[model samples]
Target: MSFATPSLIDAARSVLIVVDIQERLCPVMTDPRGVLFNGARLVRGARRLGVPVVVTEQYPKGLGPTMHDILSELGDGASSAVIEKTHFSAAAEPLVRQHLESLGRRQAVICGIEAHVCVTQTAIDLRAAGWEVFVVSDACSSRRPESLTAALTRFPAAGVVPVITEMVLFEWLADKNNDGFKDIMSLVR
Candidate 1:
């Protein structure tokens, strides 16, 4: 089947998935500074739109905790949930799936470390399971930029839509005159 060009994210129906942005993983990412900054801004914009947020830590026991930057922005509330998993794809973890179900979210705007592994797998699986998946290219990283490049190259074939942070925010806002338009535009700009 052919896929249509992805429309803007519907904040009311969308969620943001931050995958494996743990302390140890972040430091080793290809461009930690850029990844972390964009990831943080994504969280901020997602929060402002009142979209549900979920995070996954890959084997937190050995790798380390989710970095403070992400956690600080997500906070602790009904709007966000964090899960720990040994699986690269968060959707494969029972808790993560349950949390997503709890939010009743069908579309996931995803970002994080290790693009070819966790992020890619999650995008593929989530799409296979019938959720719309959008991979936030700029907010995801790996030890080699090649990995991110590869995922961006391959995921769309598996039904994962690749997007940048600004595209996501604007889609979620949809119009400059909407109530949240200015706030999301400020974040995007």
Candidate 2:
């Protein structure tokens, strides 16, 4: 029997999407600190590797802005863009779709809050829209643990790949010889 090799995320073809890890929503999540830590790692690693980042804020006026910690990791915002969205699925937002398209990438690494709602919907829609979707499992959460469990269960059938923060950082690095290797390693260490 022959098996095809699964694809790894190529830094050049990938974009990191931070979804609704906002001020008002975060403290209520199942593991807010873990999510924030790993999400920040993803953001910093993506920046160091030159991967474009897109951050989504769901009803920022109500939820408040993306948490300060995540925002701080974005590093001067030159390589990242934030879209304020009312839609549960960020892919359904015109501006979000347009921004992702403009990045010229087909692989998306996604993380953030309300896993069963915004995160899951966005992952499924992005997958259907022809982007290879990797949902960062450790960097996503819900107010309830069951909801987060449900979202992880739904991913396989919806064609979303579940991944962790370190998997993404090392994959983006691709080799120990890569220039960003030590910087990426430090995030996980």
- The model with the greatest lDDT is 2
Candidate 2 regions with alpha-carbon error over 4 angstroms: 1-6
lDDT string, candidate 2, 1-189, tens digits: 222233898999999999999999999999999999999999999999999999999999999999989999997767799899999999999999999998889998999989999999999998887778999999999999999999999998777899999899989999999999889889987
TM-score of 1: 0.94
37, model 1: CA deviation in Å? 0.8
Scored by CA lDDT, what does every candidate get?
0.88, 0.92
Deviation (Å) of 78 in candidate 1: 1.3
Q: What is the lDDT of candidate 2?
A: 0.92
| Total clashing pairs in model 1 | 0
Give one digit per residue, the lDDT tens place, for model 1 in 44-88: 888888998998999998989988888989876679888899888
RMSD (CA, angstroms), candidate 2: 2.7
Candidate 2 positional error at 159, Å: 1.0
